[model samples]
Target: MTSVAEWYEKNLMLHRFWSVDDSQVHTEYSSLRSIVVSNFEETIKMPINEPAVGKRKSQIQEYVDYYSGAGV
Candidate 1:
């Protein structure tokens, strides 16, 4: 995905599902890291966060998992 998209997904998309109030702001490519540092940085860099208490499914994760596994 493009940098803009990545930024939006991490911030905007995730925020809708899980945000601390309405302040679901995400970085504009500022949160991104190179592959070499991504693993370490990704851990510390938070996204919008997952819903605190529910079995609610993330549409993005759901579709990706379904389509990717549908070959079976």
Candidate 2:
């Protein structure tokens, strides 16, 4: 979990745009290197998001922009 968080902190583009303190979010499982934020006991889980960076805007960014904020 620590390693995953570290890698994300070092590589995520969201970090570039916002001061996203994503240390609380860690990957518990990944068949495709996707990001899955969940509780520590594994009782609750959020949707799995595949980090996609391209020349154009990504879906995740659009979602964030639409909502105006993110959630746990």
What pairs collide in candidate 2? none
Q: Which stretches of candidate 1 lie above 4 Å from their native place? A: 1-55, 69-72
lDDT of 1 by residue, 1-72 (tens): 235335655654422222232124223221211111123224433332221222444443354467773121
Error of 2 at 26 (Å): 20
TM-score for candidate 2, residues paired by index: 0.32
Give the clashing residue pairs of candidate 1, or none.
none
Give a tens-digit lDDT track for model 2, residues 1-72. 335444544664212111222233333421122354444455554444433344455555566578886543
Best by lDDT: 2
